[model samples]
Target: MKKRLIGALLALTFCVPATAGDITPRLSPTPEQAQAAYLSAMFLSRYHYTVKPLDDALSEQIFERYLKALDPEHLFLTQADIDAFADTRKQLDDAILQGRLSIPFALFLRYEERTAERLGYARSLLAQNFDFSQNEHYPLDRSKAAWLKDDAEARDLWRKRVKNDWLRLRLAGKDAAAIRETLDKRYTRLLANSQKSKSDDVFQTFMNAYAGAIEPHTSYLGRGSAESFDIAMRLSLVGIGAVLQERDEYITIRELSPGGPAIRSGKLAVGDRIVAVGQGDGAPLTDVVGTRVEEVVKLIRGTKDTPVVLDILPADAGPDGRHTLITLIRDKIRMEEQAAKKSVLPAGDGRRIGVITLPTFYEDFEGRRRGDKDYRSASRDVARLIDELKQDKVDGLILDLRNNGGGSLREAVDLTGLFIDTGPVVQQRRADGKINVESDSKAGAAWDGPMAVMINRGSASASEILAAALQDHGRALIVGEPSFGKGTVQSLINLDQVARSDTPKLGELKVTVAQFFRVNGGTTQLKGVTPDIRFPSAFEGDEFGETRFDNALPWRQIDPATYRPANEIRAILPELTSRHATRANQDKAFANLREDVAELIKLKEKRNLSLQEAERKREKDSREARLRTRAEADGTAGPGDDGLQSSERSLSAELAAEKAFKARKDVLLEETARIVGDEVSLLAGSKRLAVGN
Candidate 1:
């Protein structure tokens, strides 16, 4: 197998563009090159798993899919070019099937030339228009239509755009020489960073193209990204915990950390685009469109307690999107924010339910690396929390993994152990088809009380593993929406380890070399774990599930592992479902949640418009005029009617009443605590059996 793999890699090197710099240059493939590379790599990899040797027909199909992904609209390719490429398709297919890596250097050179030409064109535009206000303004979705049609047209548009951009920057009082220097420096850094990546650039590129062909959510994490993954799992960063990705010219929000300032503010949404950022009030907002994610991160992150304001253009806003200035005070991330937070909820009929909200299975990597005696790990923390909850004498436990994207696999297994006697928590099936059963590897159950695990479309990976294990073993009742169905396991292989020398600077590559299977022989691939009692979640749209993703692995079953049911949890599920339904229907908070989701859906569906369509927009905007007018009026108004008839009136009687109410609420934390305590007592029914007792 190793020999075959090495043979394949050698063949791949021949197909890949050769390194041309003192340091091995990791280059981006042109549209044509990307299509060829993607086809060859995907076919080879899939064939390695499915067939004894690569087949010619499969290679042709792979080529077709690759081309379709790269140029689906067929706008970029002319009839002659398509015909010419089609004529050579057979030979290319044979080369890939035969594992003949030696593609002509001329082809690679062409790819290099194309890439250089594109970069040079982009640089020319930057040279001409630094400010970029007037080249051509089109909606993000329409950008490809406008610019990526033909080389000549694209070049012309870029030239004009760049000229206008530079003019604007000059107008803004930036020195041209300094700007040029900065650009050069940034480009150098980017190239250097790319070179430092340890993973095979060709393979990483193939994965990226494969992911792009599938869906936005499916991504291949290169070696450099493994560090990022570690950071994400740890939930610790110097900057604001918002992940952004370039979608067209704008940087779109990819994910929001559970306890990040952005989530706390409740203003920034996943689809919002960041246009500009300011260091402080009245500071010039720097346009960051088309900037690298790292540069954007640098701009957004600041020293603790320093405020950085972002001018966001929400996806739902019109073409010239409305600007929302969000101010966040930066600080070092707290690991606890990403851990499970425990609370006692009144589950009526004298039952105090322990609610453990697992935001994400987090681990403090930096602290652990530093050998801190009290370094935090998710499983340990959760285990302690479960013990505490048990001591509180809670009758039932609700492990809420809603919106959790998963984390450390070890932690997941350990967390699952807390519910049942030691058993296999998950099955890891490697590329070689060897299945490793990962068991609890720990002592007795921490809290074996009636358990309900809540999941949603966002509950993925390790989260899915835990939920599926608990449900399969009858240790818990799965509730809420279906899990995210990301059952693959990615192993972060340090490129440095593979390198010939220790000081070699190649980064890392996190490849999905294995797929996870559940103890019951079920794989949570495209078919996620279905809840025992499904509940409505905010993200229930048709487009949001794993099933919507193209190329997602199909769900299958394996042999179920033997395990004893912790308790008769299913018998109580029906009653629990009924009770939850009744309570949810009557709960004001739940109603509010539904309303919020509806409103958010409405907001996200809005689109951009041309200046000519502004009038029509205004007509539509009139219906919302009352709300806008009320807000505008509120900005200038004092407290209430003071009968002074002045432009700005003093605080009024009604205003005083509102302020008094706010003050009372502010001082009523103790009262609120007392109320919660009473509710807890009433729910527990004087059990005196555990901790709260």
Candidate 2:
């Protein structure tokens, strides 16, 4: 296989692009980057689950994906600029294979030029008064829109964009003078960030373009990112404890580390955008709208106990929304903080349902390797938690895996063993078509009574493996929405291992090496583990999760693994579903949650918003009113009487938001407990009937 792979790569003709215009690059690719590029290409081509060739077809894909990666919203780079690089459209494969990065670097130089010009134009518009009374609409999502035809078209879009930016602040209650200063500083900072782009940035972007063109999960981890990944693995992140991603011009929160300040404060959430950041109290806010992700990370990261204040644009709030200031002290996220926690909810009739919230399938690999008797692992932690719950005399259990973005695979398998005797839990199929089964080798069950596993769109990888095993074994009822649907397994290839002694330190290649499946013959790749009883979800259709990625692998099935089913939950699932529906419809919190989710879905589907101030105000007011009503219904304090329209930071308002946030989170869990209550009742009735028979 190795010989054949090398032969295919060598068969491709390597070529180079001519020097691009008189424009001098602020940063140029080094020999190290070239070597990294070649190494990434070779590894991705050989080990990636999908075996597409490195030819013209993939080259064109790389070109388009690279353009998208640079300007995802099509806000910059005119048609003329795109046309200038037409010659290199089908040559990226050859260039990347040979470690020649002239074309990509040249393209990046042009992108940098365009970015500076655009920001300059945007800043120039700050002096002019926008006619907010005019009935114009700004396209909120331009990801699928066509690129600008020329410089004239680009300026026109910028005019509207600048107008929209101005109006957002105005509606949020900023004076014209303050708005002008804020926007000017924002654009200036953006231009400065553009000029600060380095050679490594260009290489990382281009390599990711090549990687994402093949698969969504696979990518090249540059030196900086590689170091961050290592730090996270060591469980010693210091800062706000938020995982951020660069989306369009904003650094958006992607995930929050469990037990971290972000989650503890309950102010930040997935999808909130950090617009500006400050140090301590009353420090000057540094606008980070268009800053590099790593740069923003540096700004956010500091010594423990130092406070960082983030000016946040809440996710539900559109680009034209109010900003809230959230202050959090920097602290290290330790292993003990991320350990599993348990709680018990009364289910009437003196019965209790135990809930175990496992943030990730974590394990102390170093401790285990050193043969430490007290090595921390998800299975071990959960086993101890189960013992505590058993001592509490719980009648049922709920394994809450919502927002748990997966972790140790060994722990997932071992955790499965706790509820089932030795059996195959999951299967993996490699690129070479070799299938391997991972099974639970232990005997006996831990609290094998009525149980359910709760999952959501954030649950993935190891989480999917465990949920699938439980569902397939008929050991637990899968509840809530479908999981993240990441069935492909990625293995990191350290490029430094293949480098010569004198070669510059290299980065790593995270490639999709295999696809995993459930034991019941079906792969979870695209179609994640579907719940037997689904709850009302904010996400609909293919709007989120793995289905959102066009390059994601397709779902398929293989031969089922040999295993014995424990208890048939399917037999009583329909009855459980009916009971859940009846209770959820009657419950006030559940009804409010359904309404909130429906509103969120609408917001997600909205692609355009009125540029008119009056119209926008009416819309914003109506939305905030609903939020206030939802909070009132939940018996929690909300954004005061004026709502979240105020941009000023208020201790009272912050407290209200925290209360509302916690209440919203509990809505789902409370309903899940009710469903589990139904399970306990049904199972009890079934056994009683059996005894009578």
Q: Name the candidate that leads on TM-score.
A: 2
Q: What does candidate 2 score on TM?
A: 0.80
Residue lDDT tens for model 1, 1-693:
244643544444344343221222343333323323433344335532222233455445444544454344433333443444565445544443333323322223233444455445656544542323322442313312422545675565445434433433343345778556544444333333333322234434434544444333334554446556776677566667776775544677867877778888888887788998899778899998767666678688767778888999987876586788888878676555566788876644566777788887877767878998876777778888888988899877778787888888878887888776677889988768888899875666787655577778889888999999988787767777878778887554343343322552334434455678988888988878898877555565245767765556666777876565543455455655565567667755455446546765664554432222234335345534633554474432123212122211222333455566545321112212222233334334332211110
Q: What lDDT score is found at residue 374 in candidate 1?
A: 76
Tens digit of per-residue lDDT, candidate 2, span 1-693: 355644454433132123222334476777677767776776677667897778899999999999999999999998899999999999998787666678898999899989989999999888888888988878888988999899998998899988887877887787989889878866776687678787788889999999999999898888888867655444466787887876656898877888889999999998799999999889999999878888899899889999999999998898999999999999976645567899999877777999999988877666789998976678888999999999999989999999888877788899988877578989999988899999876666676778889999989999999999889888888999999899988777666655532542568888888888899989777788899998889874376789889889988899999886755477888899998888887888777777778888887778887888888888888977877776676654244333123223233454466566766558777777877888888788543110000
- The C-alpha stretches of model 1 lying farther than 4 A from their native spots are 1-207, 210-220, 234-336, 343-353, 363-375, 387-395, 430-434, 503-507, 537-542, 587-693
Candidate 2: minimum summed lDDT over ten consecutive residues — where? 13-22
lDDT of each: 0.58, 0.81
Question: Backbone clashes in each candidate structure, one number apiece?
Answer: 24, 0
lDDT of 1: 0.58
Give me the runs in candidate 2 sitting further than 4 Å from their true place.
Answer: 1-24, 237-338, 370-374, 500-504, 631-633, 636-665, 685-693
Best by lDDT: 2
